[model samples]
Target: SSLIGYGRGDVRNTVGNIPMEWYQDYPHIGYDLDGKKIFKPIRNKDELDEFLDKMENPDYWRTVHDKTTASDIRLSDEQVDLVHRLQKGQFGDASFNEYEIHSCSSGPIVEKKKILIPFSVSKMVHAIKMGWIKPRKPKETTPQYYDLWAKEDPNAILGRHKMHVPAPKMRLPGHEESYNPPPEYLLTEEERLAWEQQDPEDRKLPFLPQKHSCLRAVPAFSRFIHERFERCLDLYLCPRQRKMRVNVNPEDLIPKLPKPKDLQPFPTTMSLVYRGHTSLVRSISASPTGQWLVSGSDDCTVRFWEVNTGRCLKTLEVGGAVKGVAWNPNPAVCLVAVCFESTVLLLNPALGDRLVVGATDQLITSYEPPEEDKEQAVTWALSEGPEHDKGHRLTLTHPKGVKQVVWHGKGDYLSSVMPDNTSNLQVLIHQVSKRRTQNPFRKNKGLVQCVSFHPLRPYFFVATQRCVRVYNLIKQELTKKLTANCKWISSMAIHPGGDNLICGSYDCRLAWFDLDLSTKPYKMLRHHKKALRGVAYHKHYPLFASGADDGSVIVCHGMVYNDLLQNPLIVPVKVLRGHQITHDLGVLDVTFHPTQPWVFSSGADATIRLFT
Candidate 1:
C-alpha cells in the first residue's frame, strides 16, 4: 500500500486508489490536488552509481522508499528502535510497558468494577435484622369476576340510547304469496326454472307462488328460515340514519294578513246600473268631482249620466263604435274625450258649472294652426257644419283607427293609441288647448296594448305586449322600462302618487310595479278566473280594483309606504258581481271616482254598473 502526504511544497495526488503501472508510459505520474500534472523526477543514476551510493551511504539500511512521493525517506534512531520492538512482538510506544500493574494513587478505582462492590453486603443484612431499614406493606384487595357476554344495564350506561333509530318494518306479503292465489299469479315451468337459476339478489320473489287446487295441498314455505336469517343479517350489518321530522301547522305556512272586515271602505256591492246602450259598453269615465259619469259603447252611442241618480241626461249617436272614453282629470275642466274609428271627439259634457264647461269648450276650440304648419301623423280639425250641434266641438283624425285615448292630468294634453302595423303612427300626443298633435315615438316597439299619463310628472307610460316603457316627454328619451311578467298587457293605471303602477294582462294576471324599486314587477296577482280587461286606482283612497271577463270586479286594498326599505301591502277585500257575461265579453272597462272609493265597471251586457 502507498501513502500520500500534504506538505509545504507538494500536495497529495488526487488520483484515487489504483495501480501506478497505468501511468508508466506518461511523463507525468498523476494530477495534484489543484488538478495540475505531477511530473516524474529526472533519474540520471545508472546501476553502477546506485550500487556506489548504496555502499557509501551509512543510513542505507534505515532508508524506506515512499511510493507516493517517488523518494527515499531515512528513519531516525528512535524510529528504527520502534520498528525493531514492533518486529519483536512488543508495544508500539516505547514508554508503555506491557507487564505493568495498574493502580490509582488518589483512591481505589471505582468505575466499571463489576466484580467488587463498594459497600459490604453483610452490613446491609445486619441493618435489616436490626429493623433499621423498612419495606413497604402490600395493599389488601378483594377480587371480583363478571360474565363476558352479559347484557349491559341500559340505565347504568351513560347516554347509551341517544339518537337511536328503530329498525324498519318488513313489507307485508301480497295476494300473490297466498297459498291459493289466482291462476295468473301461478308461474310457468320455464319461469320457475329461470327463477331457480338466477342470483338470489336478482330474483323478484323469495319463493315462487303456486296456485294450490285445495288448501290442504299447500306445503310449508321452503325459504322461510333462510329469509329470516337474511333479515337478521340486514338488521345487524346495514347502517341506519336517524331522521328528525319537523311538525308544522298548515295554517302557519300562510302569510299573515289583515282581515277584510278591518280593511273596509272599499266598494263592496252594486249601487246603480246605467242601462241604455244596446251593445257592449267598451269604456267609461267619471268626472273629477264624482258627480257625473259618461260611457261609450259599441252601439255607436255615448251617454252622459248623473252618477248618483243613474239618469242618462244626454246621448250622442256616433257614426262608429266607441272604443274608449276619458274625462279630464283636472277638476277645473269639464271635458270628455271619446275614441271611435279613426277620430277622437272632444266633447263638453256641459253638466257641471256652466262657466267651467264654457271655458273648457273655448279652450279646446281656440287654437288655429299656422298655414305654413307641416302635415303630421294626426290631423286636427273642428267639428264642421251639422256635426257642430251634437256636442262634438273638436275631432282628432288619425291615419288609422284609434283603439284608446287617455288625457293628461292637466287636461291640456291627451294621448291616443292606434295599433296600426303598416306605419309608425301608433301613439300620438295631442294638446287640446293648442289644437296641435305630435307623435311621441319614432317607431313602434310592439302592438300598443294601452297608454297612460303619469298623474304628477311629465312621464308617459306606453305599454306594449310584455313591458311598459316610461318616457320623459321633456327629455325626449326613454326613462325606464318595466317588465310586466305576464302575457299580453290589456290595460294600465298609475297611482295618483306617481311612484307605483299596475298593469292588467290577458293572461288573467295583474302586475304591480314600483317605479323606484326595480324594472321588474314587485308583485304579481292572479285572482281573476278570466283575462283582466281593465284596472283602476282610486285617487284619494288606498284602494284599487280590477275588472275581468268573468263579470266580476275585485277590489283590493293597496297601501304604499313612504319608506324605501318597505314594500307595498296588498290585500284582496271584495268581489262585486252583478253584470252578466255576454258573447264571451264580461267587463270591458273599469274606472274609479276621482275622490271616492267608488268603482264603475262597463260590461258587455250593455249596462254600466257602479259599486260604492
Candidate 2:
C-alpha cells in the first residue's frame, strides 16, 4: 500500500475551519514540523479556542519563522561568544606531540575546533519562543468559523455545508471479572446426585461393569469416557429428560411387521388376570412347564398361582419384601430364586406349601397418636430376627440389600446387584453348590443398570451408565469390555443365540448391539415415551419385547439371520397399552411365554395381564 500525501494541509488549518461537531468523531488530526500526518488532541472547546486565538496573530507567525531558522545553530551564550573568538583566529595548542602518539594505526587523536556564525542567535530564538517579544498585530480579519459572508457564498468549500449526523465514538465492551461457585454448591437434591456422578469414585459400578479400580485410578478420565458416550448419543445422563433431539437417518425407522393370524388373536384379548398381591407387584417369572406363574410383591410375600386359573395356590411369608423373582432354567433343579432386602432365598416351589419360618423383628412397637392432633404412621421396615433354617430354602446374605437377582443358564450360580453399596462389593454371586456369596469388585465402577449371564458361555455381562463389561466366571477376570456407543442402560436382554444384545435406556432409547459387529450398537431406536424398565427375548419365537414406565410394551419380530446376503430384520409387531400407572409407576417387569406367542405384563396397578 502507498501513503496518501495531504501536502501542507493540517488540523491546525483545516479542523477549526470545519463544523464543530466533526471534532466529536475526528479524534485528533494535525501535521508534524516536517509536514507529516500527526495527532494533536485539542482536549476540549476551551483549548481549541485558545490555540486558534494565538495562531491567528501575525506575531506568532513571525516567531515560528525565526524559531525554525535558528533551530540548526542552537547554542548557549558562552558557546556563541567562543565561536566569535574563534572567528577572530584564537587557538589552544598548534604544536603536535608526535612522541606521545603510540602509532598512527592504533587510533586517531581527536581535537576540538570552534565553528563560526554570522550573528549570535541564542538570545533571539529563546526570547521569541518565551513570548518576551510581543506579536505585531496585522490587518484585522474575521475568524473563518464565524465568517458569515464566506459561509453564505456558494463558491466556498464549507459554504454548502451538509447537515449529517456525526458518528459515535469507537469503543469495545468487556465483561467484569467475578468468581463462579462450584457445581456442588449450586445443586439441589436431584442435581446433587448427577453432580456427584461426574466422579467415578462417587458412582457404583457393580459386577465389573467398567473395571472400577483402573477407572477410579483416574476419576477425570472415567467420567470423560462416560460423559462423551452419552453426549454422542444425545441421551440425558441426568434423571430428567433433556429437550435436545437426537440425529436420525431413514434407516432408523422401526419397520412395521405384518400381523400373523395366530399371534393376532393372542394380542387382541387379555386371557387371564392374576390378582393376589395386596400391594404393587414388582417381579414375575413364568414356569418352564408353563403350569405356574410365580410373583413377588411389595407386600412382603411370594405367591405361586396356577397358569390356567387366576388362583393363588400357595403364599409364603418371607420377612423382607421380595424385590426380584427368577425361575431356574434347569428342569432337574426346578428352583425359584427370590430376592429379599438382604438375602437371596432359593426355594423349590413344588417341595411343599408351607410358610417360611423366621423370628419376626417387631416392625412397629406401638402406634401412639397425639391426644388432640392424632397423627398415625405405620412402619414397613424389614424384620431382622434370629435365623431359622428351612429345609427347602437356600439363603445368601447381602449386607446392603439387593435390587435385582439374575440366574445363570443352568441355574447353578446367580448374580445379584446391591443398590445401597456405593463403594465396594455391590455385585454378589451366589453359587448353589458352594452355598455362599462372592463379590467381584473392591470399588464400584458406576451405577449398576442391569446384569445377565451369557446364554452359552461361562461369562456374564454387567451394564452400567455408559459401558458393558463381560467377565469370565471360571477365570474370575474381565474378558471383554464394550466401550458402548450408547447412553445410560436401564435394562438389557441377550438373544438366546448369544449373538445379539439389546439395551434400553431411561431416556426412552433402545439399542441393539451385535457381538460379532462391533462394541457400538448396530441399531438405535427411540419409540417409547418414558424410561425403560424391562426387556425380554422369547425363547421359542423370533421376537423381542420392551416394557417401560409409560405403561406400554412393544413387541418386535427381531429375527437374526446368519446368511451374508440377508440382513437381520426388526419389525415392531404391536404396542400393547393396557397397564395403567399408579403412584406415578407403570409396568415394573415383563416376560414372554416360552412356547406361545404370549406376553405377560405386570404393573403397579396390582394386576397381571396375560396376552395370549
Candidate 3:
C-alpha cells in the first residue's frame, strides 16, 4: 500500500472509500494490491518514549497519522513545497501559467464560396414534381375545386354582416372638472380629506375643482399621464358590445288560446249539494250512467245521492270511518265498493235499475271456493240478515286497513291497497266470480299510496311515495316504472286513452307522464297552494280536475292529440271554490261524471258538491 500524496499513485486501499474506524479492533487495517490483509504497524510506545521521540525527532512537525495502515506518514520535500504554494493561494503546479496569448494566424485557413440559382428554375422543378405541369389529361375525372380568386361581389358573402357600429364617445368635461368653477361646486377642507381617503373609483369626481386667476395662469394638469394610463387600461381590458334593439308588441308574445266561454259544455257553476254526513267526507264516486253518486265519510256512514237533485237517497252506518268508495265503471253492472278499516263491503246500492242491482248481488255471491283452497289473501264472507237488508251483499276482510279499492273495466275484478308495512301485503287483486285473492308483490317497494287499473289494457299501476310502477297483469311482470319526482304521491288517474297518466302529490305538485314517451314526468304543474288530496280525469271530455287542501278545485282542459309528434295542451279553465277548510282539511276526493262535463267533490265540510 502507498500513501495518497501529490504526484503519487493513490492505489493503497482495496476496500474503496470507507471509514477507518470500522477496522479498529481487527489485526489488519485494510487489504493490499494482492487481496491479502496488510497488518497494522507495531509501535508500542510508552509515555516516556513518546516524550523522548517528540524532543529528539526533527521531522515530527510534518508527521501525520495514516488510519488505513495504522501508521504515521512523513511529508517529502516536494509535497511540502506544494502545500506551501497552496497555502499562499498560488497554483500547485509551478510550471503552469494562467494568462497565455493565443493567435489564429498560425493555423491554415480556407475560404467559402457563395453559389446562387435562378428563382424561375427552382419554381419549374417544384411544379414538375407536384404534377402541376401535366403533359396530358388523366383517364380518371379530377375533383371539383372552387375558384377562390374569381371576381365576385363582396356583399354577396354569407358571413359579411352589413351593420357597423362605432365606439361610444367620451363624456364632456363637467363644471367640476373646470380650472375655474362656482363657489358652491368647491369642496370644503373636511370634504377634501374624505375624498383623499376614499377609493379612486368611489370618488364622485375624478378631479378636484379649483379657482385660478386666468387661463394662462393655470398650472399643467398634474394627473395627465396617470389619467391617460387608466383610460388605456379601460380600452384594453374592458369588453364593449353593441346589441340591436328589437321592437315587438307585448300582446304578440302571449299564446293564442280559445276563450273559456267558447269551451262551453264544461261545468261552470255549482248545481247541487248533498249534505248528510256529520264528519269529513273522505271519498266520492259517480255511477256509470251519471244518475247516482255515492260518498263515504269519516262519520262511519255512506250516503247515496241523486245526481240530478241535492237529495241524500240513503245513508248506511258501517260502524267504521270509510276510507274509499268506487262505483263499477261498467254500465251493465250496478255496484259500489266501500272500504272501511280492514273490511271492504261490496254493496249493490239498489238505486239504479232493479234488474241490474239484483244481478250484481247474485254475481257477487255466486263464488264458492273448494275445500282445499285455504291460502286466500283475504277472507270472503256473506253479509247476511241486517247487512243484506242494507244492500251489502258480501264483505271482504283483510289483515290491514284497506285505503282504496279500484275495479277493472270488466267489473268482475277489483284491487285494493292496504299500505301495511309489517308484511309484503300492500296490494291484492280480487276476482269476485271465483272469490279468490292474489298478492301480486312479494316485497313492497315502499309505502303504497294508491292503486289503479288501466282503462283499456290488462295493467295495474301502483304508486309509492316517490315513483309509480306499472305492472302487466297478463304477463305478471313489471312493465315500466314512472318517475313521479314528487315527495309524497297522494293519488293517480289514467286517461281514457290509456297512453298518459297523472299523479298528484302532497307537495302540491301534479306530474303528467306519457307512457309511450318517457318514464320521467313529461310536465310538472304546480297550480295548487296546498297539498293535493285527489285528482280525476273526465271520461269523455278533454279535461281533468284537482282537489286541494286549499278548498278549491282547479279544472284544466288537457287536450291530447292523436299525433305522436304533438304534445298535449294544458289550459286552466275554471277554479271552483265552495268547500270550506275544516281542521286543516279541504276537499278530500273528486270524481267526474261518466256522461256529462260535470264533477263531484267530497270535502271536509261534511258535504258533497257538484259543479255543472
The lDDT of each candidate is 0.86, 0.67, 0.87
- What TM-score number comes out for model 2? 0.51
lDDT per residue for candidate 1 within 1-612, as digits (tens), equals: 345233477556767777777677678878877889878788677999889889999888998865554566687787789889989999989899776657655354534343354356667878889999888899898885444333455652222433343558997677788989888788899999999999999998887887778889887877899999879877986796546599999999988999999988988878898999999999999888889899999999999999989999999998799999999888888888999999898887678798898887777666678875537677777886677767778877888899999988888889999997677889999887777788778898888979998888889999999999999989999999999989799999999899999999999999999999999999999999999999999888999999999999999999998898989999999989999999998998898888778899999999999888
Is 1 or 3 the stronger prediction by TM-score?
1
Q: What's the lDDT for candidate 3?
A: 0.87
lDDT of 2 by residue, 426-541 (tens): 67676565344456766668878679999898878988888888888789888777765666677888899888888888888888887877787778878788888888998878
Q: Which stretches in model 3 have alpha-carbon errors above 4 Å?
A: 1-256
Which 10 successive residues of model 1 have the least lDDT summed? 156-165
- Clash pairs, model 1 backbone: none
Alpha-carbon runs more than 4 Å astray in model 2: 1-268, 351-392, 483-487
Where does candidate 1 stray beyond 4 Å? 1-247
lDDT per residue (tens digit) for residues 1-612 in model 3: 335462344336677677776687688888977798978888798999978988999998777777776767788888888889999999999988865434565433312111123466788889999989977776897875444434345553321433334558997676777778888889999999999999999998877799987899899968899999879877886786546599999999977888877776778899888888899999999888888899999999999988888788898989699999999888888889999999998888888788887777777777678876657779988889978999887789999999999999988899999996677999999888788889888899899999999989988999999999999988989999999988999999999999999999999999999999999999898999999999999989999999999999999888899999998887889999999999999999999999899988989999999999
- Candidate 1: TM-score? 0.62
Cα distance off (Å), candidate 2, residue 601: 1.3
Best by lDDT: 3
Question: Which lDDT value does model 3 have at 383?
Answer: 87
**Which predicted model would earn the best TM-score?**
1
Q: Each candidate's TM vs. the true structure?
A: 0.62, 0.51, 0.61
Q: Give the true-structure RMSD of model 1.
A: 30.3
